[model samples]
Target: MTAALDVKGLTTRFETRAGHVTAVNDVSFAVQPGRIMGLVGESGSGKSVTGFSILGLIDAPGEVTAGAVLVDGVDLRQLSTEDLRKMRGRKVAMVFQDPMMTLNPVLRVGDQMTMAVRVHQPMSKSDALQHARKALEVVGIPSPAERLKAYPHQLSGGMRQRVAIAMALLHSPSVIIADEATTALDVSIQGQILAEVRELADETGAAIVWITHDLAVVSSLADDICVMYAGRIVERGTAEQVIGGPRHPYTQGLLDSIPARHEPGRKLPQIPGSTPQLSRLPEGCPFQPRCPRATDLCRTEPPLDVRDGQAVLCHHPLEGV
Candidate 1:
């Protein structure tokens, strides 16, 4: 089956006083309809940059240097600016980390949502509002009609987020890029939203790319997983394979750091050292400086190793347990 979204060899760079720093280095992944792919990594690992690059949102000082972003087999990279803007909400939509980033402090929920719907589709205000109300209902918001009349500040954080998500659904986008959409909510509310997101994918047949640093969240929510280090995906596989049997040392370290995987009283383990500075990354493998399995062979660039539908970019990958 053709992927709903396919990203190939994506590379994004920022021109700084020092030099060009590659923020997203040859990253690639695909998501099929009704499936959720978790793009997991530490901050500065390029997960968020990858999301923005896919949507053609990279600006000034930063440019998408290479790659093809295909939505429904059409290369988004080739579209004119006006055409790309048209495709953003109709074919793909992004839910930002902060609901406020997508909401207007001065506008009522209904007003913003109806505006969003009418942007891509010419329709009567009432018709657009009906679409907005249904979207809120789809995301499990109660009293959708009443809530639409309320201002953003009038609602709780979770409710505001639900409104933001509802707006993303106004167009029934084929692909949704959610950048830490649930990180701000309390655990219970986050769980509720994750469950609703799963249902939304199944019901709407929308491919979702969930970008987050929290492995615990993705372990429960994602069908597939991509573990990133620096700007590259070091490992890609089903959630079972990546979370349950991580091959790359960075991935293994991330899994080990999850507190739930350890005893309650014991201290949590952590990946040693921090994410590398993009411009000053090591000569070869970016993770080599922090990787325990690194050897002289690792000083040279590692080739992509594929086995049993799992791929790893490591000279000495851990054995599948």
Candidate 2:
């Protein structure tokens, strides 16, 4: 099947006083229609940068140096700024971590959504409002009509997030990039949103790029997983393959740190050393300094080892038990 979203050799860099820092390095992945691809990593792992790069949202000081962001076989990088802006909400959309980033605090939910609808489509205000109500309903928001009349601050965090998501779906975009969309909500609310997202994917045939640091979230919600470290993808596989049997040391360390994976009351295992500064990354594998399994071979660039459908960029990948 053709990918709804395909990213190839995505590289983004930042120009700092010290030097140029590569925030996203040769990252590549594809999400087929109705599938969710989890881009899981640590805070500075460039997963978020990848999301912004895909949407052409990278600003000054940080720029997407190379790559092709293809949505429905159209390369977004080839489009002009105006064209890209038009494509953003119509063919592809993004839900930011903070709902406020997408919502206007002063505007009523219905008014904002109506404006969003009319931005790309020439529609009457009443008709646009109807579309907004339907979108809210699609995200499982109750009393959609009433909720639309309320201001953003009047709703709870989860409700605000759902509204943001609903707004993203107003155009029926083929690709949706969600950057930590549910991180602020409580677990129960997060679970509820995840369920709704899964349903949205199935019903709308939209490919979702779920960017998060939480393996647990994606373990249940994603069809595929990509583990990133130091702006590079370290592993890629089906959710089952990556979570059940992580091959890369970095991936293993992340799973091991999850509380549920350990016995009660025991201290969790952690990958030693924090993420290296982008400008100061080591000569070869960036994770080598923290990897217990590292050897002389790890000091140089590691090979991409593929077994079954799982791929790990490591000289010594962990064997499945």
Question: Cα lDDT of all candidates, in order?
Answer: 0.91, 0.92
Best by lDDT: 2
Error of 2 at 304 (Å): 3.9
Clashes of each: 0, 0
Off by over 4 Å in 1: 302-308
For every model shown, what is its TM-score relative to the native structure? 0.97, 0.97
Show where candidate 2 strays beyond 4 Å.
302-308
Per-residue lDDT of candidate 1, residues 260-304 (tens digit): 789899988877788888889887788898888888777787644
101-184 in candidate 2: lDDT tens per residue? 999999999999999999999999999999999999999999999999999999999999999999999999999999999999
Q: Report RMSD for candidate 1.
A: 1.3
